[model samples]
Target: MKKYIVVALLCLTGLVQAQEALFSGQQVSSPQVNDDKTVTFRLSAPQADTVQVTGDFLPSVKVDTPMGKVDGPGKALLTKNEEGVWSFTTSVLAPELYSYAFIVDGFKTTDPANPFLIRDVASVTNIFIVSGKQADLYRVQDVPHGTVASRWYDAKTLGFDRKISIYTPPGYESSTAEYPVLYLLHGAGGDEEAWLSLGRTAQIMDNLIAQGKAEPMIVVMPNGNVGQDAAPGAGSDGYYTPQFMTPETMNGKYEAQFKDIISFVESNYRIKADKAHRAIAGLSMGGYHSLHISRYYPNTFDYVGLFSAAIMAREDKSGAGVYDNFEETLETQKDNGYQLYWIAIGKTDFLYEANEEYRAMLDKMDMPYEYTESEGGHIWRNWRVYLSEFVPLLFED
Candidate 1:
């Protein structure tokens, strides 16, 4: 018995030593931000023949257009040293949040050294913030932050219980204030968690409200997928299936069911339930939904914003048409005394042409609206900028 115990102890010691040597703290010091504002990335891939870094800092070559460039962070190849560590240094990056991944011989993966990550609908990548001036807006500052709750509510329009993320201002819990509401919707393939995670909605709101740039209001982020009750894996429904990609699920269902979300919010929260205090805005599919919802119920929302919206003027076979009596709808909406009808899109966004067509229609109808164009493509970077700009302009008399 004594001999067997000794042998077992020796084996356990060897295992611990092997793990310590393999994951020594040296390899964990990757993604170090240099004093010059440039960044150095390292990976301890002793056997990897080739490793490359791809991120938003790399410049992207446009594929769809001739003589144009797609917006990207830029890519760089790493150099391996005698110690079997691959390293690469970047030029001074701009002050903002950036996501990146390392490709080892062809297999893409997040940095093991960096645990901070952002998961989108289709992919997951590591994230880092290069902070200084305006980039501070994206960072969590030393301010009284608001509370973000993932609350479940009944969606009678869809006949299932659904979840929505709501952000109440800092004083909401303590103060007896009835605040305005902003129905902030997410894009396709996203859920209630998307805006809070990748979009940094809470950080932006906290910073903006602290700086007095935006009013203290409640922001509701609802799951826009009509076929699914919550984010994939959050409920019994597994990952989103392909059958829900039809036009019926995409166009009409969400708009028809949105009233339930509003009713839930009004009944549960201390919100000023009036058109003048209600706002709706979304990105991509959510933008399309916002457009239709505001149009379908013209008096429901006083502020409407479309961020890189996928607008189609034609009628859908699914009975979710946008342009059926579109001129009359716009005329009636204009007569309803809305506070703001805003549209923002990136210059390199693939949906730029669609937004232009919508703008042209609005111009032809002589409708009053605000248009903003920024630098970048159809990425979260531009959407964040648009939100920052749009929130400040909301609820201001």
Candidate 2:
């Protein structure tokens, strides 16, 4: 017992030292919240060199806008406090989710003392969730809601263990009947976690369900990319294609992950496991997949959604996806069965032209679809809006 006590003391001492290292020379400890909804951060490197903070999540703000401050609503001051220790104070920063690392003398490192963080293995980044006045679509409401299941599944056809995230809607737990499934996909470089973390899809469903705009349904987000599908013709050197993925390759995967996600969601979720109740949707690459998969199977899905969809049909290119003939594929699907083909894209998204062209092609082919052009770019704002409007229209007569 004495030995254990000594060890605990040592750990506590080390923790205190680390904490001191982080909080050193700061004018204010925790950044003060401002009335305008922002927080400021301060950093000082007076004696030695310059100081800057960078993070995986920090997008470039407008000029003159200080760190942690949204639109420069808050202010931070950096000045010399002592011989070497500098004092820095920041203006308020907007809260939602943010990650940052202190760049002392040009060295970037995470604050060791701060506990708030999100992990992706070896690397750790700070995250802050500030309450926003904007309505939250995913917040649990009075209506029954389902939980998100994060798991891995094997893809037999493509040959990979895909990480999958499925959001089962409210009333799923107690309902005697199974719910319909919507296989959702994420964009480039994003895995299954993208939709839940950034998209707030489940919350969007919750708000809509509570308001009676959308029926409760399951949403599955699968990874897209056989191997980082980049600018289509950037050259075969980095091109992620159908043949690129074999049973052995693991580091960069796409097709295999998608196949497994679908199979896993069907088996695991108490879903209406048939073609009539099944749907597919995604943004960017995921949108491309939805177009391909629905067109290929046709009868497998009853509803299809594409947000800022990357549906670039290459006539000469053979192995971008499972579909062989794009025209015949859609024709056969239209013949076999059709569902709600709803596609929404931002006016500024790179895929906007493709979306419009796809719509025109659909019109020529007499393929029924619902197309929406909203005000925004290919970002989360448009995605959220698209989801908010689209969900209520699902599973409807």
Candidate 3:
């Protein structure tokens, strides 16, 4: 007992020392936003021989004339000053959220000074938002904020308890209103937390609702990984890394399991619970899931959105029988009379050709859909923009 007590005391003392060491320094301003809209990034790695900063702020180049632009991994070298600080200033960046990292002595790491960070699958990086004019839509304004909850529900189809992230509009608790629901999905390697943290879904919805651009609604973000019940470390089943390359993770399990999510939402929330009031949208793999789910479950969702969707012409068993009886399914969906079918992708996105092919197919079938072509490649920036645009058009009649 005495030995155990001494060991605990020593561990406590070491922890205190470590905490002090973390903050013992002259505070340096990092990721400093300048009046000119340029950003200054700084790091105090005195021992590092070389330091470089890389981020989304760097413009992507057009590799092929027709293929669109692609962002290559690039970095800007920072200059070390006499104060043992390495720093770099970026050119004036457009208003948007950007993720960045530092490459010091051949190792990449997040900025030590920045507390705001986002975890994307296996990696984590620091993030900053540039705000003004049109970009303000992605920014958090002084509007009435919505409430976001991380909750779990039983997925009888999957035979396990699953987790989801939900956003209820402001006044939802007090008001006796039956609201509309938007089922938002994350891309490959993402889970329920993706939209809440990286996509800024709450802020976008709140801003739009405050401006009367979008109706007050309940947003549902569900984990798309079938093998995993929730985001990594959030479930008792243990942390399962999303296997994007394998059929086990990409299989139609989630598509078949989607109904469970809807049932849970309808039962728990005061929602309209009708085809016209229900909407579905997603990005990347989530977009693919949305396409399949809306296709198979015709007449269930009146509005559907696909952002940088991973579309293919061939049928695959992994995707819940996607492209199986494709014509018949679409015809049935069209006949069911959806309010809106929207597809948006970046001009430089690698999926640009696939989107064009899908558009051609839609044209061949005489089905109607609103197509939006924006600037940028397959990225979260475009996904956020697409959501803001798509939400305002929902349930508009």
What is the descending TM-score order?
Answer: 1, 3, 2
Candidate 3 or 1, higher lDDT: 3
Name the top TM-score candidate. 1
Model 2 stretches with alpha carbons more than 4 Å out: 1-19, 22-33, 42-135, 138-145, 225-261, 314-321
Off by over 4 Å in 3: 1-21, 24-26, 61-73, 239-247, 313-323
- Which digits, one per residue and each the tens of the lDDT, describe model 2 over residues 1-397? 9999999999999999999766664443433345675544444455656655554224433333111122211122234456544344333444444555566676665544345654321234554444463334544456656688766666665544545567877777777778877777776545556677667787777777777877778887765544322222232344343231222222223432454556677687777788878778887667776787777666777888899887754332224455467798799888876668899987656566777888999899998888898754555556766777767777776
Candidate 1: segments with Cα more than 4 A from true spot: 1-6, 62-74, 238-248, 313-323
Residue 31 local lDDT, model 2: 33
Compute the lDDT for candidate 2.
Answer: 0.61
Q: Could you give candidate 3's per-residue lDDT for residues 1-397 as a string of tens digits?
A: 9999999999999999998768743376889999999999999977899999877787654444222455544689999999888899999988988888999999999888898899877678899888886578778798898999999989998889989999999999999999999999998778899998889999999999999999999999999887777787788757656444434454667777789999999999999989999999999888988998898799899999999997753335444565578779989999999989999999878898889999999999999999999988877888988998999999885
Spell out the clash pairs found in candidate 1.
Answer: 56-73, 57-73, 57-74, 58-73, 58-74, 58-75, 59-74
Candidate that scores best on lDDT: 3
User: Count of backbone clashes for each model?
Assistant: 7, 21, 0
Error of 1 at 155 (Å): 0.9
Q: How many backbone clashes does candidate 1 have?
A: 7
